[model samples]
Target: MAGDAYEVLLTSTARKDLDKRLRKSPAKKDKVAKAVKRMREFGPTYPSFNTHQEKRTSRADDPTYISYVEHNTHGAWRMYWKYAQDKIVVLYIGPHP
Candidate 1:
């Protein structure tokens, strides 16, 4: 994993969404935790996407173009990351809902 650059950055909105979901349902919270653990172990390799939405306006001006993969857990969570020179940079994690 040398030369690999990975980071997880969660937007405020996404954080709030996850918090809301976790507060609303205990089952969902467990599922979310499990999914995140899996992601940490395996990286963002699930819920592959052929196409992804353009970066949000808040992040549009950023030079890096972040790609996302959607994971279906209790509701749905998104992993925003980028790959460069065999390195995967995980930029965000949060609930899409």
Candidate 2:
């Protein structure tokens, strides 16, 4: 069931990657913002988007599940995240790399 509204966070790595991408492609800022808004409004499992689980476990050291939000753009972008408790912590955001 949908619990209380979940909080979305970005890890340092994610923040760094996003910053770089935004700097290089200012046009992507709006898309990134929309993606984040969707995450907040619909949580990590939004049905409209195809989100996939990541094989690399978690960076938080706890039992974690990794996932991503795919974005269509000139260079395909993805928003990676880790789910735990009531938060979705973004781990990365950039062109598939």
What's the residue-level lDDT of 42 in candidate 1?
55
**True-structure RMSD for candidate 2:** 4.2
RMSD each, Å = 5.9, 4.2
Model 1 regions lying over 4 Å from their true place: 1-5, 46-97
Distance from true position, residue 59, model 2, in Å? 10
Alpha-carbon local distance difference test for all models: 0.49, 0.70
Leading candidate by TM-score: 2
- Reference-based TM-score of each model: 0.44, 0.74
| lDDT assessment of candidate 2 | 0.70
Best-matching candidate per lDDT: 2
- For 20-44, candidate 2 gives per-residue lDDT tens digits of 8799989878878877887887776
Backbone clashes in each candidate structure, one number apiece?
2, 0
